[model samples]
Target: MIDSHIHADTRPFEDFELMAVSGIEGALTCAHDPLEMTSFDVVMAHFRRLLTVDPERAARNGLKLHIALGIHPRAIPHDPERVIEKLPDLLRNPSVVAVGEVGLESGSEIEMDVFKVQLKVADELGYPVIVHTPRRRKAEITSQIMDLIDGTMDESMVVIEHVNRDVLPELVETECMLGLTVQPEKLTPEGAVEILREYGTDRFVLNSDMSSAPSDPLSVPRTVQRMKMEGFSRRDIRQVSDGNIRDLLKISQI
Candidate 1:
């Protein structure tokens, strides 16, 4: 299973720790382009300025760590374009998977502008967008994104993050996939179940979304277990596990 979103802000456990603990094959390590990776150095076992993970390290640990480039919302105020301009090169690497953790937020004016620029970049580069929709404006921001991508993107070319309650119908109508973070946070497990019931496990996906939160690393396994206990079918559980995520990321399973 792949954690569609994650931040490597820790030092004691590197990015693969999630897969190691979950007994899953891999996870996507969201490397924030704007934050000081050093500030959160204490959590990871080690910090490498790796845009794409080192295969040797990942193989040694029995996991695959896929990295993506994005400047998260909080760090958007920094010269985001300066940081963003480097993304295409990062995406050029065979291991770099996608182009976000991008999109609008009502957090700040800088956040909005920076997100706009990043959205445009993600559109231009043709990498799948990992969007964090605006607070309380899921419909509004999502509508705008739909309009923006209507003519340009293939509709399946973006991934909407479930940072909060999803506007599931709107997300589905937009022909995009929803990324549900099923980490160990309170309310997350239950919340994910609800979305799965509403959207089902196909277009919906499960991610750890773990960065600074005390959420469990084995979030996907926990999700799979809880989902089954909640009466979700094996096929549905498999969708949350790797089917939907691998499809959205276009990773080959065979």
Candidate 2:
């Protein structure tokens, strides 16, 4: 399955190398603040890096990387106008896939403004929006995100990521797709399998959300394997592991 969100800058290429060996098709590589010039410059840098690393990546059968550039809501709030200016030009890059890791958070007023701006940018261009809800406070965080999405984004166009046990019901009620990272964070593979069984295994996408710390677990396939042991049908395992992401990314295969 495609990792819908990732930051290659913070993690070494080695981590990605391992994931590719596990059957990851591609990871949409993303980054936040730039070390230098214009916002577009950051977009250019990720694309440059993706091009540079891709052949080496292919040699090792690693996940192919795609790039997306936009302000993350965690850094600031939603601001429609400012985002409008930044995102349109950024999307011009053919390697850039979507506008994201942007959305509501339990941040200050400024953060809300910035998120709204980027969300509008996603809407304007019809780009798929990758929404981030606060990991520290998943329930309160999800409420904030749901409110924003209800007012702005089409439910089908947004992918709410890093979903854990907390907002599972809200996830079903809102009918918004979810991205679950099964790496060695607070959650375990067994625990994640329980979630899939409870969540109905539809419209739920799996991701790895890798970094340098701990194992990536090559989460998609790992989760798929566990679900099978837990009595999940082969068809359901494939649905969450790969099928949903194909639909969410609007691509043929991961």
Which is the leading candidate under TM-score? 2
TM per candidate: 0.79, 0.83
- Per-residue CA lDDT of model 1 for 1-254, tens digit only, reads 66666664442345565467566787666644334423233112122454423544665677776766666664453345556666666678777777767666554566666666666677787778777765566677666656655665566877777545546656676678877777554346777787678766667778777666666666777777888798888888888888887877777773
* Per-residue lDDT value at 87 in model 2: 62
Per-candidate clash tally: 9, 17
Quote the positional error of residue 27 for candidate 1 in Å: 0.8
- True lDDT of residue 89, candidate 1: 68
Candidate 2 has an lDDT of 0.68
- Model 2: lDDT of residue 59: 40
lDDT of 1 at 233: 87
RMSD of each: 4.4, 3.4
Candidate 1 ranges with C-alpha deviation above 4 Å:
14-18, 33-48, 52-58, 107-109, 134-152, 163-166, 184-186
